[model samples]
Target chain A: MKDRKPLYLMTPALAWLTAFMVIPCLLILALAFFRRGLYGGIEYTFTLENLALVFDPLYAGIFLKSAAIAGLSALIAVIIGYAAAFAIAAAPSRRQPILLFFAVLPFWSNYLVRTYAWIVLLNREGLITGLARWLGYDAEMPRLLYTEGAVVVGLVYNYLPFVILACYAPLSRLNPEIAEASRDLGASSWTTFRRVVLPMTVPGIATGFVFVFVLSIGNFVTPALLGGGQFQMIGNLIYAQFLTANDWPFGAALSMVLIAIMMGLLTLQTFATERASGAKREES
Target chain B: MASLANPRLMLAILAAVFAFLYVPISVLVALSFNDGGLPTAWTGFSTRWYGELLHNRDIMSAAFNTLVVAVVSTVLATILGSLLAIGVEIRRRKGRFLETIIFAPMIIPDIVLAIALLSFFSLLNVTMGLHTVILSHVVFNLAFVCSVVRARLKTFDWSIVEASTDLGASTPVTLVRIVLPVMLPAVIAGALLAFTLSVDEFIIAFFTAGAGRDSITLPMQIFAMIRFGVTPEINALATIVMAVSVIALTLSQRLNRGGLPGQ
Candidate 1:
């Protein structure tokens, strides 16, 4: 009875997950191999055309563009977030919790609201344009909204706090003595950070980077609203295939590819984390 | 070491980052109160838009649907997740496969899950609605709740359970009398977090909600409104939604002082 307790306790959740998550994901994999019907329904016959179409130049270009945008957003988020985390870690210990709390507070709010906030600020009659006009010689307002920059900004804004939290974990846990030892060895601050602190914090950086990149690449909302329906990230393409275009097979194929990219990044992140911990163990 | 770097430089970075995080949100909140409700100029402060929100049937229905989904899903997730956490933690041999199964929902891209569930439902001929949205939301919500409960369980002492059994207390009685009290805070914390996530979750709900205006959630409504254009009513609605999530999450963080979900 004692041994069986654990099994019984876990059954409901396991059953729920298998019925909902696992089966659905596998169904998507199967759906990708089928053909689309003339009327937008799934055809019973199996075909690899959807997979081949994913690799075609037209769709492939969207994938590359999505990767580039996700990459750029990840890079900017890491830089800004790392700096913020570093500053928080350097603050007085008493103040650190309050600071970190406030830093992460906005992240818990409605993501659409946060994204909408950007639209309010970047639109033609937005605060930025208004500020520019107030401070300036009369000139035509630049098109700030409905651009690639707006999408990138939206992605970074929505995901930045997670990066800060990730980076701050390693930074906060870091032994200051390690940095002091480097400084005492006559290394400059820059050299100390690059060679000593940065290497140790690679796990955090990897986690943050992979997280932002994966989410950004699959993001449809930011591109749809901020890109003004003009920019077509892989997310937008997939959305069209499913909702508007009614190409379920193609959508599933694109999703499989997205999952592949995500798994690859996640595997890399795990390797980085393991290596970082192994290095720490050796150092001690 | 802290003295080695310019304190002023650190403060500047902190200031800049905080501004980046808060400025956009602050703008939305401020604009919600603007009488004219246009970004171009603020005529005066007014609560007219918020008043308008009350009279808007679409917004009201969506808000009610969101409430139904969030409450139902959070309850279901909390019970299942807490039990799973206890079971997983109690087992002496934890497999990597089991860990992956538990963690998958947290890391899986929202788009992937959204479409997967969408496809799965349609294939089964299950009519999608607020109920389907609730079902899908549970997939991720349970994962989050489990992790939180599991984090709390990490510091849990099994000796107490052993002692309770030694006293001839039955397992169910021990769980009810001993375990439940100790775990209540974390359980509630996890439920609050789940509620917030469900309320704000859009993509999955959007996909699984089928083609019906009645089942629309707050975030889906917000997304549709935002695409058309930002309006003063949306500003007011956004403010309310943000406030609810912020408050729930703050209470969650307070209870589960160990860490927030992602962190």
Candidate 2:
């Protein structure tokens, strides 16, 4: 095996990725500086106009709104998912895998189908309304579908499994003795959890938050389907720029911005995780 | 403290979550068989929707296109991914840059990759179709397959390969007779996973399928039909698509000795 130098075997996959992914991404970075053609083709002429356009109030407003919605969804998902993961980890050890599987199964299904399920649940004549009417309240049903709440619900539901998986890590690995020792020292369960458990799980929550945030912020599907064209996220804007508006360079620029936002969040998340892990090690 | 995690309450919540996830799917499945299409009312059961799907030319063509893409992409990815996994593990150093590049396809927002591919294809004047979509799908699919195979390979014993080589087996001969046999299950599992992913993938396909009705894959068709508003046929199609993914994943899991937890 030593004589063979297996690096040659790695070349095909590396070459394929570089040609398609790395090079293309770099191409988009370069393309962002070029001028948009009058007829949607890119002109090689250099300009900062595309990046400047992203900062313009109209698109900037969408970016802020997207961040708000993504943040809300991530926050809510982590709360529910952390509680659930805590419950599962606190269960018998033998059962954790099965519980986690069920928790994550919805995530592996078609993304469109999962989002569509919420449409069935939230539409005017949908399940929630049907239940409301079934309770004999004949008042006009408020518009629920295509709202900000519905979008949040879709994002939370779609990204919730990842939250569970992320949160489960710290929960399952948590040393019960520390919490017990805290309790023995006269701390109440809530106090122990607040002072100890929560701090321990912060890194997991940060991870789940960043993941859900990054994915949901760049998500086109939920906004397209659940928000129903009334609201536009960065993802939907990018989609429209490419497909509907026929503006490739602009779309490329939006994608670059999206990538930058994701990378920034990810870097922050990594730093948070490293710091937390360091604290954990130091305490140990 | 124990009562806070009440067994009944936990069971109920678990049931509720599963019901929340599964009921709509089950409803879609049932509605596809309903003679009447509305969710509000369920008439007698029938196979009419499935029959209709079978005969629908557009859906059939889309399904065919999806199959072609999935099969070709999965095969290519599995081969590339398996070899890459073996290579990386065997070599095992000084490729952090390559590792990040390979892993980027996995973590990069799908929209970013999708539009990047669209831009890349157009910039190259590459004629886009199922072919271009296949190329794009392979980019990510290979990453997934490599990860899966590499996980299994981490537990692999290298001495046998060394011993085989010492016994004068050629590299190609040793790979075929030794490494391939040991890695067969993982490769198949990886292929199934890749196929499932390729089948369910929408965004990249949406961008790279070019300007033609001919290249419309099932998910793209599903997206369009969905936008045209809910139909029993879509419910039927959704049920089928979900079933394919579930079955593929379940099979892959069983083959993989319990699938990767995060997938």
Candidate 3:
């Protein structure tokens, strides 16, 4: 017992991850280089055609659309989430925890349910339409469900809590005196906020933005439910390719691209954070 | 102050944001209790829909399968993750590669992982069912559980275990009696979190479920039902599912203290 290493204890869990996650992920990489079989399985011969097809105009259009939706969702979520976080940070100190807790409480609930809630709200015979009809406005409103806008709203709803949590960390930790100091030095309120407040919270903003974008761009459920399958995002395309289309090789290639984009953004975020904080680590 | 000087503005932002966050959920919850069970009007309130859940065989079986997955996965994850957390903290080396392997499960897109596992299992010619879903779930669940337990271990008193060993206790005994007690809260919190995640999980389970009715979990059932369209029954089902997760998470949060699950 005395001679036993603690590293031995890590073996089982780490081994499980390596087998299930690591191996599977590597398999996906291997899968991308292979050709699709006539019977819709992987062929033994290797080729770069699948990877190249990811940039084919049709798929690239979906990627561009996904990026646009993801970007818009992230942007909107950040603005709203930042304001909510700021409001939470400004409340009486005793109530801040409660506000923050409730702010994120919905996030902990089922993601599907949250998405379904929007379905109920936006459906033709749904709550909003019903309310509108009851309020004497029945002139054939444009259908809301199954649109790109609905997809964006659902994406924003699902990820807003994460942004709130992300932004709240920096906002809560911000020192009050800095703002007052800038104000005392004759900086206007807006100027003080723009110069003194927002810059310091860049890491949080970056984190929130990256998270929303990454999750949204690859999201299948929200678009499937809210977009009513009217539009295809990268996620739906991947789903179709793998499950419906039986093009596993192509799906794997698309995933490789998705993973590349995710890793690149994360690496950039890490660099940004380090650059932002590198100046303050004089002693270290 | 890290606050808005304009109280009116703060109030307005908080009100609007909270409304935006909560209104849809509130509508769903309200409809679940509607006696008329239509979005058109609030006829009255009743628990009939809740009662109706008992008679639905598909949902009942799906719920049972979900419970099996969540319970089994949580137990395995808790044991393996606690050990992993303890082992990592006790070791001197901070291997970045090891860190990435552990954290990748947490950060990977659920769809990518789902497809990856689907491909892996198919390539291996393994039978896909509830068992495979359990296996796939442990990949992420253990990572989350490891993270939670590891956070507690950061402030852990290592000397007690050393003292226990010096006082003639074996390593296993010291861990069981001393370390486990200190880590019990985090371990439980981790288990609760894992349970909710597994219960609510859909995509991976859907892929691994292998086109079978028996292995269908709650979320997969919900997905199928949702694709067909929304009904009052779904609203009731959604309400119950949401409540279960919210309660589990709230309890987990209480046990962990101050730190939310993801953070």
Q: Point out the worst 10-residue segment of candidate 2 chain A by lDDT.
A: A1-10
Query: Lowest lDDT 10-mer window, candidate 1 chain A?
Result: A1-10
Model 1 per-residue lDDT tens digits across residues A18-48: 9889999999999999999999998989999
Tens digit of per-residue lDDT, candidate 2, span B1-263: 23224577666656666665567666667777889877677788887888889988999999999999999999899988998988888874647786797788999989888888888888789999999999999999999999988888787778988899999999889888887777777888899999999999999999999989999999998888877666778888888898889888988888889533333
How good is the docking of model 2, by CAPRI class?
medium
For every model in order, the fraction of real contacts preserved is 0.74, 0.45, 0.79
Weakest 10 consecutive residues of candidate 3 chain A by summed lDDT? A275-284
On residues A1-284, what C-alpha lDDT tens digit does candidate 3 reach at each position? 23247778899999999899999999999999999999997788989999999999999999999999999999999999988988888888899999999999999999999999999999989988888888999799889899999999999999999999999998888888888889889998788888888898888899999999999999999999999889899999999988899999999999999999999999998888787677546624
Interface RMSD of 3: 1.6
User: Candidate 1: misplaced stretches above 4 Å?
Assistant: B1-3, B258-263
C-alpha displacement of A88 in model 2, angstroms? 1.2
* Candidate 2 Cα outliers beyond 4 Å, as residue runs: B1-16, B258-263
lDDT of 1: 0.92
lDDT of 3 by residue, B148-202 (tens): 9999989876887789988999888998988888888899999999999999998
Q: What shift in Å separates residue B156 of candidate 2 from its native position after superposition?
A: 1.7
Model 3 DockQ reads 0.72
**With candidate 2 superimposed using the best TM-score fit, by how many Å does residue B216's alpha carbon deviate from the native?**
0.4
Q: Of the candidates numbered 1 and 2, which has the greater lDDT value?
A: 1
Interface RMSD of 1: 1.3
